[model samples]
Target: MRWAILRELAKGQSLPVVEIAKRLRTAPSAISKHFSVLYHSHIVNNEHGRYRIAPGLLSADRQSLDFGCFLIRLDRLPK
Candidate 1:
């Protein structure tokens, strides 16, 4: 799911939450949670509520680690 989000943003275009939610066939809230994780982890950048792929995140080395690292970070949050 996170990979799908990254792939869609990898096209180098900024997209709003609604558009991403539509493409993923999920509820807006579901996409929002993923987006929040991505944004907080610096895997994606959000500008004025629109998200764009961040620099250096599309490299081959970052492929699967991004989501794994993101999950790790989420676990550390004050839950």
Candidate 2:
């Protein structure tokens, strides 16, 4: 679910919990929970209730997230 959320965020748009939940077909509360984890980990940024992948984390191709020690590929995410 976090991966899915990341995929949505990788599109380079800041989104609120409600929008993310609607896109993923899940509950907003559940999305908030995931966002909490990502937010604390510094993987996502939150501003006025909207969230997005933290700057400098996305690869140049926008196909993966470069986390220094690991990479999260987004190309295979289901539409």
Candidate 3:
């Protein structure tokens, strides 16, 4: 689901919830969970009720956390 969001948002344009759901072939509610998490995690941003990939996330590297996914960090290099 997140991968879909990433792919869609990779187009370098902002999208509203309804359009995003349409592109992804899912219900609005179905994708809302991912949108909320992604927005809160700094992976995505919302403005005027539309969403776009956060610039910081686009420029930064990411690491996977085996636990406590609610935690996100920047300025850390992977070993």
Candidate 4:
């Protein structure tokens, strides 16, 4: 589910919880928990209730995200 969210955000767009839930076919409440973890971990940034991947974390090529522990290749995830 996190991967799915990341995949969507990989487009370099910040989105609100409701929009994310709609894209994932899940309820907003369901994703809020994930957002909390992500926000705390600094994996995503929250601004005015919108979330986006942290800056300078995505590779220059935009093929993957560097979590400082692992690399998540965007193309490998389900669309």
Candidate 5:
């Protein structure tokens, strides 16, 4: 669920924590918890009051490529 929220935020230019909670239909505290996890993992970053994907995450090229492939497969499945 945290990964889902992170991916959604990744698509956005940037998002505030409140806005992210609204979009995810979850509590702000829940969002904050997941945000903490993502922050610790260095997958997402907090800038001022907004969140964005961490620039350094791209250094894990293999993992990114694997995730892209997984998304492609998931997209092909029946909804």
Candidate 6:
């Protein structure tokens, strides 16, 4: 799931939730849930109704350490 989100974001374009949901063949609500997880994890950022991969999440250094460490400090978003 993380890889899917990362690959989609790596396209370097912000995408609407509906578009991403269609591409992934999932419900919008499901996409929203996954997106929220990624957002709170700092793997993605939401802005102005669109989403983009966060810079720090893709750092090579981040991959070297346990990915959970980076996400630990982020607060879980309300559904």
- Global lDDT scores for all candidate models: 0.72, 0.92, 0.71, 0.91, 0.65, 0.65
lDDT of 1 by residue, 52-72 (tens): 877655544333324435432
lDDT of 4 by residue, 1-79 (tens): 9989888888888999999999999999999999999889898999999999999788877779987788889989876
How much is the lDDT of residue 18 in candidate 1? 91
Q: Which number leads on TM-score?
A: 2
In the range 1-79, model 3's lDDT, one tens digit per residue, is: 7777766776677999899999988999988889999888777889998998876555333432222334333224231
User: Over all chains combined, what TM-score does candidate 6 have?
Assistant: 0.67
What TM-scores do the predictions have? 0.70, 0.91, 0.70, 0.88, 0.67, 0.67
Highest-scoring model, lDDT? 2
In terms of lDDT, the poorest run of 10 residues in model 2 is 70-79
Segments of candidate 4 deviating more than 4 angstroms: none
Cα lDDT over the full model 4: 0.91
Worst 10 residues of 5 by lDDT: 70-79
- List the candidates ranked by lDDT, beginning with the highest: 2, 4, 1, 3, 6, 5
Q: Write the per-residue lDDT of candidate 5 for residues 1-79, one digit (tens) a residue.
A: 6656655654645788888899878899889988888888776788998887777443232223133334322222332
Q: What value does the lDDT take at residue 63 in candidate 2?
A: 91
Order the candidates by TM-score, highest first — what do you get?
2, 4, 3, 1, 5, 6
Model 6 regions more than 4 Å off:
59-79
Q: Over the stretch 1-79, how does candidate 6's per-residue lDDT look in tens digits? A: 4556556666667887887887777788888888999888776888886888776554443322125454422222221
The model with the greater lDDT, 3 or 4, is: 4
Cα RMSD for candidates in order? 7.1, 1.5, 7.2, 1.5, 5.3, 7.3
Backbone collisions counted per model: 0, 0, 0, 0, 0, 0
lDDT of 5: 0.65
Q: C-alpha displacement of 31 in model 6, angstroms?
A: 0.5
